[model samples]
Target chain A: MKIEVIVFGMIADIIGKQKIEVNNCSDTTSLQIKLTHDYPKLCQQKFVMAVYKKVITGNTNLNNGDVVAILPPFAGG
Target chain B: MLTSKEISRYERHIQLPEIGIKGQELIKKASVLVIGAGGLGCSALQYLTAMGVGVIGIVDFDKISETNLQRQVLYNANEIGKYKVEVAVQKLSRQNPAIKFITYCTQLTNKNAIEIIKNYDIIVDGTDNFATRYIINDACWIANKPLVFGAIHKFEGQLTVFNYKKDNNTIPLNYRDMFPTSPAVAEVPNCSDLGVIGVLPGIIGTLQATEVLKIITGIGTVLAGKLLFMNSLDMEFYTFEITPDVNRKNISIEEYLSYDYGQFCISESQNQINEISCKELKELLLNNRNTLQLIDIRDQEELPKVPVLEELLIPLVEVIERVSEFDSSKKIILICKSGIRSKLAIQMLQKKFGLRNLFSLEGGITEWLKN
Candidate 1:
């Protein structure tokens, strides 16, 4: 399955882009594995993954055209 | 019951059918505890007070800095070095005489989060650090109070309400549910390091205040079980529904007390690091000559740069990443605006690099220049 990914905050800075496309990403856990494999710095940073418009803590099935938002915790007020 | 004067003051709000006299009374009865009187706190506090929240509790231990003027509009140029909570409460009290302002001029820690947060009906987390954010979340969850959460980075802002009760069947999501772990202290940058547009916090903080108002007045959909992301530049708002993790441990009071929240900010263990007095350090500098390395681990903007010492500048946050820049073979003295950050820098050096050649200057550069 192909998925569209959107990154925010430092994650965008790390990945060097706000939007990207990943292929054969069947689930959120595998997507995380593939993402960290390409952008290893993400492994050290803390963030949450939201599929479409819902946040998921564990592995959830992903379909084609699904938008995955990589959101990191913001410390500034 | 609102007095005639109170009714006249909030006449516009009372005129609205959704928030008539009954809603005004509910607003007057509600109390909100806002942690951290920084950018978000300032913005949220202004609206919350103006909306007639009866009791407003503010918690902050930071002093007003010149840099803060860009974002924390609560303080004036003359108020620099004064405690934020003191100035914020003083100004906000004048904004609403009917509202009672409870000022806590101290940092919110594990010891005080529960006791202080339990007193208020809702918790507004405006803290600028991840450590305090988690502490606030855990405390609010344990106390069973709704938490209005807002945080900003550059032009982007996030707003959410956690542990909120609505129609109540499925449990509400807390901060831990969204981000289970904290980003490494060294990797994360704050407002100071990465500049944030001043209006970003105001926008997010006002949204947070709105959530608090909705929670109190029982109107509109509160931002519970979802995260709202906004970009000031693009003017876009997107909310993501959050699902709870069954595996995450329940945050208990005992677990909170035992957890070292300070590990994210500073050292918690006994101060085993060596310390040198200003006079002694001067003598050592004079005798050791060029052998010892004098490193000022404070932000460059900090005043009274020691031209005589010619210390190397490396801010505390960059200490871990810049460890290779320090020559561990030589005796290195770290100096900061106050002595606290220098000690933390030294700890970082020792912990990350295992370098024992580090020493913290007693009283920091401010004391050193006093003589």
Candidate 2:
């Protein structure tokens, strides 16, 4: 399935603003695996993914066309 | 007849339809204490005072710096060397003399968190770090005072109201419900390390003040039980419904205080990459007679090619995958557009190869371009 993983802050600068389509299973962990496998740099750099608008831990279920955002630690005011 | 002092001072607020005589009286009677006179606190104070919130107390231990002027609009060029809370007190006093202002020039640690926040009708969190965030949340919860919270980062910002005493069950979520665990501190970036769009905080901070007014007047929708996440780039906002975390409900203020938020949030070491001024790096490059190995970790598409005496092309993503290509023995200083990726690269290199000499070019090539 194709998952549109949006990146923010420093993470966006690293991954660039684009959707990554991965042929993967249905859970968030698998998508994370595919992302780490495709983009090796993300493995060590810790990131949080908000599926739909709520932050989900690694094992949350993912479906087709789900909006996943990769948010790095926010450094704002 | 209106008192001569009152007529001129709150004439504008008195003219408003919703905040007419009754609302004006509420403002005169209401009291609010804002914690942390940083980004959110500065903006929150400005709007609340301008709106005629009667008594506002600023609790903060930090002093203003030249860098704080970027988003902290309360401070000016002359006030650079003053304490944040004290300066805020003086400036806000002049902004609305009808309102009473109190200033505390001390950090709101667990020891004084309750005593400081107890007297106020509401508490607005403008604190930057997690330890203070959690401390304020728990103290407000214990005091049973409504708390207006605002946080901003880069182009994104978050605002929520918690612990509203009236209809308390309707507004049950706190910060803990959103983030069960405090993120490692170094991981939590602040405006100091990452650049912020200056007006972003103004928007979120205003939202916080709005919530405070709403709760005080017992009117309008407070952001209770809902977190509003806004992205300025798109001018879009998402409201996430939150419920109290069952796991964390039993957690007490003492437990919250016991947790080392500093260590929890800032897990990364001090050596992470950040931009140093080009002038400083230039002095180091010229004065030191040592040979340097520069690694450009940007994609081929980025502009303003770095003209260094010695440099190599190694896109940040490819560094870990193709680690064998470069001689790890050499002194490898990483470079990127900003300093964030290079610092992440340094972490990867350190963990995988135990590489110690890998230094990140502070502020990356952007700083280099200025030189």
Question: With candidate 2 superimposed using the best TM-score fit, by how many Å does residue B240's alpha carbon deviate from the native?
Answer: 2.1
Query: How many Å off is the CA of B339 in candidate 2?
Result: 15
TM-score of 1: 0.85
lDDT of 2 at B23: 74
TM-score of chain A of each: 0.95, 0.80
> Which segments of model 2 are wrong by more than 4 Å?
A10-13, A18-25, A39-51, A54-60, A69-75, B1-18, B165-168, B263-371
List, residue by residue over B73-153, the lDDT tens digit for candidate 2. Answer: 999989877898888888888887777888898877766788999989999998776667877887888878888888877
Find the number of clashing residue pairs for candidate 1: 0
Q: Per-model C-alpha lDDT, please?
A: 0.84, 0.72
Scoring the B chain of model 2 against the true B chain gives a TM-score of 0.71
**Candidate 1 has which clashing residue pairs, if any?**
none
Please tell me which predicted candidate would have the highest lDDT against the true structure. Answer: 1
* TM-score of every model versus the real structure: 0.85, 0.71
Cα-based lDDT at residue B359, candidate 2: 77
Candidate 1 lDDT over B1-371, as tens digits, reads: 99999899999999999999999999999999999899999999999999999999999888998878998888899999899998998899888877899989887888878999999999999988888998898988899999999999888889889998798586887888877766655555434556789988888889999999899999988988888888676677888898777777787889888877754333354257888899988898788867788888766675777887666888776788778889777888888765766766766567767788788888777678788
Please state the error at residue B56 of candidate 2 in Å.
0.9
Candidate 1 wrong stretches, greater than 4 Å: B263-290, B293-327, B333-345, B349-355, B359-371
